[model samples]
Target: MGMNEHDQTKYIFAQSIKDLMAKQPLDKITVTDIVKHSGMTRQTFYRYFQDKYDLVNWYFEKLADKSFRQIGNSSTLKEGLVKKFTFLLNDQIFFMQAFQSKDYNNVENYDYQCILEFYKQIIHNKIGDIPEDIMFLLKMYCHGSITMTVEWAIRGMKESPEMIADLLIDALPPKLEDLLSDLR
Candidate 1:
């Protein structure tokens, strides 16, 4: 299928941001820089984005959506979660850098929400019943894990993804442990 105008513009904007991020800090990037790099006008950029933060949020959201889709197809929760984490960490390195620089506060929230949504789907599908308390715990777990993962990457991914995955799996609640093991 052909790309729509909006889709094309968004694609350019995301790429422009990625390019700019590679060269400098996110705080130094401006809409004009994006427009200039993207070869689009300021009007075109504003038509699709409110500001740089909006674009940053959108970029992470799109990555989250892709990560969720990958998780959905995996046969095991551990594998799915590991795959999603690896994908998010590797694909959005600039966001990780920003987090390390303390220039952005939304990456953790964005990742946590995406992970929780993915977990909710997995629980709903496999167990078909979710307690509110468990859901709340899952959200807490996601936030903590995402925060640690970002810190880990910022610290140079000191441990391999597999080691990190094992740590995360061990950290899960007992009920989830039973469910994931059964799935395996």
Candidate 2:
């Protein structure tokens, strides 16, 4: 259950970036700052990540994986959304800054892709085959949700996590909602 050496190292680097992000923007933070904060060498950092942006992606992916694992099969989509929103709220500063990154290849895309894949897997398992229209709708919904999430973060996340989750669930397309009714 404990972290392996590789994971441990990555965690350290992630923490360093998170701490730095609290005081500065992602674009302003450098690899040297991360290594210095993490007390690891540049070689150590490059061994695991190409840059801080890569670390941001890894951190978000880790959070997405952890959120799903915690939800498992017993929980609903609302529960999943609550957990994910909590993670974002808990690390508000880090996420607020990370969401501000102008880089196209950042957490926003990663979040959108992760959410889309999560829905696809669930829909595929529940209905066997997904129609083209449903798939398009699913992608559109995921993109909207992620965009809303980013705006929520950037805007200081004034709303409660549960409230945001409820709104997102309410916004789901009727057909998709019916398909994922049990989950919602």
Model 1 global lDDT (CA atoms, 0 to 1): 0.74
Q: For model 2, name the residue pairs that clash.
A: none
User: Best candidate, TM-score-wise?
Assistant: 2
> Compared with the true structure, what per-residue lDDT tens digits does model 1 show for residues 11-65?
8899888888888877778899999999999998888888887788787777766
Candidate 2 residues lying further than 4 Å off, grouped into runs, are none
Candidate 1, residue 171: the lDDT equals 89
lDDT of each: 0.74, 0.87
TM per prediction: 0.82, 0.93
Candidate 2 lDDT over 24-68, as tens digits, reads: 899889999999999999999999998899999998878767774
Question: Which candidate leads the pack in lDDT?
Answer: 2
Question: What clash pairs does model 1 have?
Answer: none
Output the lDDT of residue 157, model 1. Answer: 67
